[model samples]
Target: MAFKENYDSGETELKSKTSQDSPIHCSIDEDHPCDDGLPPIDGGRHAWLFLLASAMLEALVWGYAFSFGIFQKYYSTHEPFQGSNNIAAIGTCAMVGIAYLIAPLPIIGMILLPQIARWVSTIGVILMCVSLALSSFSTSVTHLILSQGIGFGVGGSLAYTPSILFMSEWFVKRKGLAFGVVWSGSGLSGVLFPLAIEWLLDRYGVPTTLRISSVGLFLLSIPFLYFHRPRIPVSHAVVQRRLNFRFLYSKVFLIYQIGNTVQALGFFLPTIYLPTYASQMGVNELLSSLTVILFNVTSVFGSIIIGFLSDRYHVTTCLLITTAGSVISVFFIWGFSSNLWSLYVFCIVYGLLAGGYSSTWSSIAHEVQHANPATDFSVIFPFMETGRGIGNVVSGPLSEALLKADGWQSHAWGTYGSRYGTIVLWTGITALIGGIAVMARYLKCV
Candidate 1:
């Protein structure tokens, strides 16, 4: 069987292959026979163990970043960092933003240097520990940003991008569910880590919390790297093809990218501001933290369900479902809340819908790859993440600006005061606009 690339259409088609030939084989595996054979694609003892380890890695890297809400609350109220305007929020956003922003570098490296690509995750683990340890010595927010935000982001991108590529090789028919399971690790850790971090922050202070977390991450992550190995033996004989830029011109890619960016702009605001918003409502610290916990816990179920849906349904349909639910929750539940229960309800609904939206990336990747097999999963995945990173990076500044708009205050309206009214409105509007991709699909523009 031979593969042919249609440059004009940006699609790759297999030429003269029998009906029994599988298109799902890795490009590398297609060129070279496997002498030391591996387990089947979707299921096997080794394959499941690899998935478990990947999930653990996901928990350790992304879980810490997602739980930054606890740290944000601490930094805002505690000494030394207290009264700083949006500094804590900036740090958290920077960490997550940079992780998404730099995602493409590892993929490029994997393509250019397959031998060295295998070691990237190990290097990431060491860098993460070192960055955390260095962060413990920070005397100011700037220092924290440099050490925790920038350092963790770089380390995490290096560590996590490999898993994205590896996952493509591991699962075929159930790829969406596999990604959901892997991603739910962050949600699972998000549920538990907030309370634990809150306890540490209360008892030990910022420096001690940083030091302890660094050590714990090192211990939890090092063992997992061993299991993060590739299933397909990479073949050096296959000449490294020049990066395909045709996807950049595709209508479908642009439509999905736009929706992804719009959704991300508002998706992170709730997690970043929920604790502070609850505090303004006179909620206690532990309970305020509980909102985030609830969001993350419910998000676990949301990701899996959405992933299953993506596998069976069109990606556009899944996007519409998520966008509608998120927009409704923000407008109806969060926007009108007067007490803790309403906020809790908003958390559950938003987490269930918006939280799993990223899980749809697997389906989106499939859509892209189905069109252009020459485009590697590494490249396609990172491009989508980069779109979200734009929203993530801008969201910090955008959120601060919205919160500062006192003129939007409505005295008669509940939770529509100067503090949160603009934010709630902004979140809902962006979520609604994020469904533009679905509209584009209906219009046949994509």
Candidate 2:
């Protein structure tokens, strides 16, 4: 009923009969689809190019955020920022947390100023370069926070939001696979950037390293803006479509959001601390960094696999796979680890499982759109990202508290006596709770 009303009012033409009794209605005509004079959907030269550029942009924007563990370790031991409490995690979280938090702004802009949607991404790229360049001059941890944290975060969100909005236009049938490929950019970059950053920090020091990265990012991003343009034109009338809020009232969305939020609370803990943990086990710096590399490399394949799964299976089913695998890895592999080899195993397993969960957003977005086509991917994704961002915002303080807790120190269970017990247990518990989203389907709440 809602879909029919929304479609009838919009620019789309309907092909099927609109009977009140029909449970399923085709909102758009397949025979005479709304013609915006664009390339074909799902597969086309422009579509593939756009997906490629988007994936690269994803790498450039999120790669640094994903590799923050290396920076965290570097800052904690280096001069200037050394001995600063939680300063490392603060910068890392700021960049990632703010990026997720501000996702809604670009979507809102698309609604209010549809004509400018194309340029928003360009502006975001400029902001990201400027932020990184400005960060090169930092003499204190606070400066890094302002530049790399807030500046990069804002820039990344600006650049990334448009991609999410445009994706639905390009690939309706294979949206999940498209999203997976785009998301894999981060995993690919995650594998490479950690090694590169570590080498740069070792040879060039922080200021030079930051400046070099700034220039490199600028060079890498500018060319891709050409390919990231929207496939369909957003007319004034299209922008005027009434925003759908029905999904918010659905029990399914509420349950999924809660689980996603809880999972996020501990999702970043291992990423932030894995290298340091490996070092504590007497592993060399290069080897410590290798842990992150392995995690990210495995995640690249994992994202593609999970994305394919999401396309075929229910979102809740995919969530269960990630949740169960992540919980098992954290509790069994990471918890009882007494050596670097065990930590390496944990990284690979966790990366393959938890790292792919973000790809499931495509499925969730599809589900929401099916219920209300008036609601675009932009609407659903920003809300889900906001949930994850909340968890990232608090993870630094939460991790510190968990690591310092004396109660968990004396326990003989797993790695409880190694000062990392609380963090391990917390990651496992949160992951388990995140699986509660699956219950929604079973209870017929969806």
Candidate 3:
């Protein structure tokens, strides 16, 4: 591990000379262009390009997951293997669930077995890619359960964690914007993939679409693989220490972690259920699904705006404001939405809040991990990604239970007339919980 240097001792001073960063990070060396101690890159056109690429990669990875709701609708009804969301979730949950469980595996390897962890981790990625391609031909639930649950989930983990780690390492001052831009991939995917996948699914059957999408996911990793490199290398010395849960025990960190996990329990439910909820509310299928698009579109701006805020405002304050706003927007706007128009309003608002939720992950990570904004963020970034992966996996099952109240063909949640209302309620509660985390930090109540 690098020795901890105080902010003043000219070590950090070297930061400003190289990049708009602290001495801890120099981003411009030939061998490690991202980490070689270059000066910080200001947020501008070059920065925006980085954002765009990050968004594209994210759209492919995170967006695909968000769009699974669209596929979920198709899977639930039209097959020789027709099933409920709960039933179908075995594959989805396993993919996501295993993704979470394996996160610290490599980190742990770094501590226990340095030499083989790197190559073995890459092999895991190979296995993950194979998992999806195999899912296309499955005829039974077990096929998907094994193929997607184990293969794709683990594969995505290996691929995604590295990209995020690289991005954090590469951009310091602009980390929020960079993360925000990449973070928007989830939003962008929500916008683009659903429409694309829906068309492909309708034109080709699920089996064919899965095959194509698997190939697409495989191909999609190339750009990230080629362009994304770690700014700073993880040192063998750094790996000598055991996995520390000290951060997990920190007041602010715990608040953020648990709150985020709880929020995620429902944060994505809206994206997954909005289209179905719309159809149940008597909206047309085409229009119903478009809500996902509209919601994602609005989220793009929200992410950019929040990225701006996170850099300009205090991270805790920015998180508090966004979380509070999200609670209000989801609870009142999405909670009571009754018609297509109401949902439309809800989508834009909710989309923006959703975007904010993601943009903060990196910025807050920097603060909590105490890494310089411009230095290699590789040290801290993966932990947050792990936190989020856990959040994503848990959100699925909890939301599936709430979403079921409306049923596939009906709008009522058992006796209640609001499926979306129930969905919104879940997010609102979780969001408020996240807000409490921020507030606890500010007030030192934690």
Candidate 4:
């Protein structure tokens, strides 16, 4: 392929090989244009703008989902939805589960119908915003599940999938850092959104809060979507590669995926149950919400730092660090928490470790790519998400079962003596099992 330079913009365009020419544009530095005439790989103004927009969009979409604990708390205590069985399913299983489960579909669609990628995302934003508005009129839990849960989940996957594809194209060397920044957007929102949602729910009630949030999300999402687009020009003539499944057979990929699934199985427990647990301990609503705030705040920094390290270290090594920290926090700090201060400490430590785990997906992708150069890194991410999604879908019913069981009672002080003792023990066990890849690394299986 030959490059055509446009003097007006100082960008080099890649000429299409097909009969219908589609030019791919990239900024070329005047003094130091590379021999390939392609845009800078790791850093550029356009790249940064794309990253910023993607991150903000991620924050807006995920921020609300992560703050579902507040809603869970509110629903448990109030109104027609109050005392509803399996309320956790509304957030964890139905909404987030469906989101993760269907994540690959849009990515596949983008690959097969590249021209419609942006349109899909645009439609997604509208669907997501409208779902919230629709949910405001819910008179039953099933209505909330259909609208807020399934509808919102579908929209989010469509809107966000493009960013995932473009992100891989934008940054090669610092892919981990880029993903970290984008993923941290959720953590950043996690910090503020919980407080904001709690305040809104308390003052305005559920119906008004949902309607207001719907309007706010639609307005905020438009500008960001404008920047979130394909790095490569997409047209009908661009020959799409056949989807490959060879990487699924790779030992390294399997090990990492197993750990990912195991980790996710228990990772969300604290987020879903911590506020309720605190309330059960006689803490006020504001203080209970504070636990979620601390968790999210620490996770923001954790995602960035973990991502930065993954760029420099082995992916398994990074997993080991997160696993160790998560295990310690769940077993020691959270297990013994008798008051606000201890629970607060647990959230900070656990959030910093566990919340940042997904940022390492870039490292996992790079690892898979290194092992199988023909593999599409973009394709690998959604499968990893699928692994986590399996856990997300199962966690609600699983936690409910554990809570209802009669055994595992303890006389010890703190959470060990509480009904959540089994949950605490299981969380720690899963965190430890999540480090299975590290064992595989030492055994030379990876």
Superior by lDDT: candidate 1 or candidate 4? 4
Winner by lDDT:
4
Query: Which stretch of 10 consecutive residues in model 1 shows the poorest summed lDDT?
Result: 15-24
Mind giving the per-residue lDDT tens digits that candidate 2 earns over 1-446? 99888977663432333322111122222233334456777788999999999999999888878888888898889898888776745544688888887787788787678779888888988898889889888878788888988899999889888888788677777888889998889999998899999999999988888888888988888889899987766555444343456777776677878888888889988888889988887878899998889888888888988999998899989999999999999999999987888888999999999989888988887676676666656678778888788878777678888877857675665575678898999999999988887777788776
- Rank candidates by lDDT, best first: 4, 2, 1, 3
Candidate 3 stretches with Cα past 4 Å from truth are 1-54, 88-92, 96-101, 106-128, 241-245, 370-379, 403-416, 419-421
Clash number for every model?
0, 0, 15, 0
Task: State every prediction's TM-score relative to the real structure.
Answer: 0.91, 0.91, 0.79, 0.90
Off by over 4 Å in 1: 1-36, 237-242, 410-412
lDDT of 4 at 432: 93
lDDT of each: 0.81, 0.81, 0.63, 0.83
lDDT of 3 by residue, 101-186 (tens): 46665545543554443344355446666786788887766677677666777775665554554454456566677677776677
What is the number of residue pairs that collide in model 1? 0
Q: Relative to the unseen true structure, what is the C-alpha lDDT of residue 242 in candidate 4, on a scale of 0 to 100?
A: 24
lDDT of 1 at 255: 82
Candidate 2: residue pairs that collide = none
The TM-score measured for candidate 2 stands at: 0.91
Residue lDDT tens for model 1, 330-413: 998898898889999999999999888988999997787667766666578888888888888888878888888867577636
RMSD to the native, candidate 2?
A: 4.8
Evaluated at residue 378, the lDDT of candidate 4 is 77
